[model samples]
Target: MPSGRRGRATWLGVLGIGLIVALLAVAWLQVRQAALLRQAVEVADDDAVLLVYQAETEYLRLRDEWSRSSDPRRVLDAPALQLRYDIWVSRVGLLHNERIGNALATDTGFAETLQRIDRFIRRADAVFAAPDGPGPTRVALQELEPELMSLGAEIHGLSLRAAHRVGEQIAARNATVQSHNLVGIGLTVSLSALTLAFALLALRQMRQLDRRRAALEDLAEHLRSARRDAEAASEAKSAFLANMSHEIRTPFHGLLGMLSLLRDTGLNQQQVGYLRTAAESADHLLAILNDILDMSQLESGRMVLSPAPVELRALLRDVEALMRPQAHAKALALHIGTDPALPERVLCDATRVKQVLFNLLSNAIKFSDHGAIVLDVQARDNEAMAELVFVVSDQGIGIDEATLGTLFRRFAQGDSSRSRRHGGTGLGLEISRNLARLMGGDITVTSKPGEGSSFSFRMPLRPVQAVPAPRTLPGDAPPPPRPLRVLIAEDHVVNRQYMAALLERLGHDAVFATNGREAVEAMRAAEGKPFDIVLMDLHMPEMDGIAATRAIRALPDAAAATVPIVALTADAFTETRDRCLVAGMNDFLTKPVSPPKLAASLRRFFGSTGGADFAPEPAAPEPAAAGGESPPLVDTAAVALALQAMPRERLAAMVHSFLDQGPQLVQRLRAAVRDAQPLELRVNAHAARGAALNLGLAALAATAETLHEGASHLPAHEIARHVQRFADLLPATRAAAIAAGLPLPAGAAV
Candidate 1:
């Protein structure tokens, strides 16, 4: 319960307890008063006065009887005279009763009057005792009558005194009762007022509670509305970013292609220098664009890490290779080191890790004109988990506390003046930190003005067993001795012209198709001499590359159906690549493609490579590891060998066909497990393993191999688990294949 309500309930309980106690006290007081009133009434019963009056009347009757006996005219009624005497004595005795005596005790004459009556009763009893013997009771009765008559006056006086005393007592009791009634009335009024106040307080509390409840509900609704608005705004931002990426990259590709073509136009020395500057600016712009796209992906939670076992030394070597040129240009020393205890192989996403290191080193080289930049790698144990720490310390103009606070904020730099001198998007550090955090790590910086800066990047240490590097096809081999036929599909006129010129320079026969549909038609019509390879553009008016590839793969003629279809697009999203591959495209190449990149792709498909004069593409840095239990999705080396042995289109068909059978394979595996048929499970697993191995679906192949090996002795549930793992790998393998350009080279799986 809420604290306010809980406190109110406790307060109410205390009030209720107090009210009950007050009521009990009032009841007790009322009961006590009632008992006192009853005792007063019992004490003032007027019984003493009644007894005294009866004695006086009996005295008068006795006196009369005695007078008659003394007259001697009525023949002396002895029995009647004796009865009167006895009755008088009895009445007088009643006056002597303890209750009556106590009531009359306050009167001084009461005791004397009772004594005199006792004397008369004693004398009369003697005469009445002899009633059955003689009639000598007349003289005795006459004697007792005189005393009894005299006692009447005393008895009357006692009665008067007793009545006066009772009256006084009754008056006093009335006064007491009146006072008690007043006190009871006052108490009752106070209690009523107290009860009314409590009721009012309770009512007010209820009203407050109702108001609070309404306020809380309103606040909750406002928060919910705010959350909805935020979500909508976030979705809009993501959409805008995606659209901008596609729009900008599509045009940017043509611009870069034209620049590259212009560079080789036999220019003078001054023109060549201008071209170099322009190329540098273009490269910088491209870097900024890539950073923006990466930031967007991070914000939208779409940046996925592809982790695998990587050689630690090889990865560091790649970083050094990329940064050494920049460092040398600035005349700065770059030193990279690692602890001896560090493992040879660690799991991580090599590309992102390299991206971060590259940014840090580049910044160091950019800022420092003198001194050295040091990058040290070490393993540190933190409680239960081990961590791999990379510290990049640079002898550059450092940052102040004020600038350090916002250093990792987007678009924020160390110093405004220095930031102008060193041009950047100011998103590199932020992107690096985000990437680090995404990999269960963080990047922290320590800097002091006029000194230097040290950036420490830490991530969980996960060691993996080192495996022998896969053998790759030779890159130094001579190019094709003869020219080959190549088809280009594109909608943009500039891009189509650029491609035609690039092919002509490479000494290859080039055929042009305006769109994907035209490309498919061209392939179908090429019965006499089919095209060697088709370079397909992804976006076109008539048909997209994905659809066209699917159409070509479904052709009736075997040779036409097995034509290699390579997707060339400006969109670099992983999802787009996966779609192209799943539609049976042989490979994917992001646009702004240089001559060397094109030459390399051609050399892989056909055994023709004569573009050796062009500069080679830079070797990509090894990615760091992400946490996963399965092997890599695709074995690039295997795929390369497969492409060498068979046509590219045939391998794509085999890969697609294998992926299509995922559901059926899952069903068969399930049935085998359900029926406890190990042989059937083994047969199915073996079949899957063979196909996956041929297609270079490494994760699927590994899963299938596990099932095939364990089917005989493994528990049913364990076998089922492996089958489920196999099922899950199908889509991931397809996506990985696409991201890695489908038929990738050795160690090129994404």
Candidate 2:
């Protein structure tokens, strides 16, 4: 039952009991009032009878006195007798009004009694008014006595009936009160029992609630302790990882630095080759460590993705640019294709996406020797989901089913041999998969052992609706041209000669600097005819390419500081490229310096529309006359003719001036190479590359490039070979110039 209904029922029962008590009390009071009325009537009836008897006695006495004396005194006695009669009549009248008429009007006996009283009173009055003086007391007495006696009897009957009815009513009220008291006692006992039961139930509920609350508090305390423990564990793990990374990096940095310093110490061919391999291993180790650190940070949720609108075309171009060199080295064909439906721009984390692409492309290049790598991008609209997908597939040594299963598993490599041959920490695929998932996408692989492998990357790429296409800079937009002043900074004399020869043939006026520092110095020193572009070497002893670039950028003069600087290096790592950019270099051109890469670098700074149209650089000048003798090896006139072929008289003048300075430059290059001073070797090589390039001596410039690259690790004897080669070429080069109607300067060998 509902509590409210129960309470209402209890209140109604109490109200009913109250009403019953009130009614019973009223009944008892009524019975008592009836009893009093009946008693009063009986008393009145008795009083009337007594008064009648007294009047009768008095009347009889008065009558006797009247009969005994008829004198005047007798008349006075009669009047007094009449007064007593009047008193008796008044008493009778009171009896009738008080008892017979008012108290018992409804009762026949009581009415008869009232009538009898009235009759008796009438007789008394008549006697009192009689003139015979109390003549016959017997006459008045006789009439009143009968009437009064009859009234008394009637009054007695009426009083007995009223008293009986009142007594019966009182008995009924008393019985009712007793029954009511019994019922009230029962109700009180029942109420007490109910209150006790309710108290017990309430106490039980309170106890149960207390138990539950205690249990909850205990659970809360345990949970708080567990949470604190988990937090402490997590913090400890982060601290350990940070410490480990720092410790590893410190030693690794020293190792790389020592390796760098080792290059300056002269080493034989075998040692040089071993050192190169070791350096490569060190680099790979560093890469793996970095990748692991990156993965750990990413898993810890410490790294945040930076999304930006990126041009897919430009991104692909960069990817191709990065991977092309690797493919060339491996003798592999790389194919990149995209659907025209692909969006111009996509919303993505450019850095992460680029990283993924680089990893994929690098892996493909690593595994493939002669096969092709195909990068496919498609934009498809499906009814369920509209998105663009990118896939990169390669015709490399494929993975088996078992290997593919664990392809993206952490720290899992496809094969032990593969890991040994092609070193990797195996975190790349795992990280890539995690990154893809974070981007609301995924990565998958399909491969067949001994056939080929295709790795596919699918991501939900949002179309960038409002991104503008990148505009080509004014310098890069124009067609290839020449007759421009080009600066070549190298450290090997032969390589410098080779570059100068190539530049002359390309119809570009070339200036020579032995090293990056000298290149910057030369540019600063020039009063007029400032070099338009600087071709910088990566590894020069005194001031490396990066440092020189920084120095040039910080120069006070605008012309020297703002000149375009391109790096010529053998290190093609992404980190190296980043370093170049950080150093304010305009571009990166890796060695062994090829004609196409060289032309491209030059074209980057010099607009194509209108420049010199020069002849091809002369191949190598004929070797010096037989066995270690005094033969003029180079044809200087031929070199001059090649320069003049560009139809630029100014370029010819530059060539002539360069030849005049050649002997002195050669002497300095020999001394630097003999001393095994990388910095000086770099300076001399750079000068020769420039001068040789200006004179169209392709062979000499190429040799100088070799000396430049190998300077740090190449032994003193090896360095001497490049110096001797450059020295032998000077005579033939001067001869070639003079033969082309460009006279050699005074004291110049011919």
Candidate 2 residue-wise lDDT, 479-574, digit = tens: 444477878888765456556755766677788777778977887886467778888887766777878887886675655765778887655688
Q: CA RMSD for every model?
A: 46.6, 57.9
193, model 1: CA deviation in Å?
Answer: 83
- Lowest summed-lDDT stretch of 10 residues in model 2? 66-75
User: What is the C-alpha lDDT profile of model 1 across 446-534, one tens digit per residue?
Assistant: 98877789999999899998676676688755345577788888765445655665676677888999888998899999988988888
Task: Give TM-scores for every candidate, taking all chains together and pairing residue i with residue i.
Answer: 0.29, 0.32
As a TM-score, model 1 comes out at 0.29
lDDT of each: 0.74, 0.64
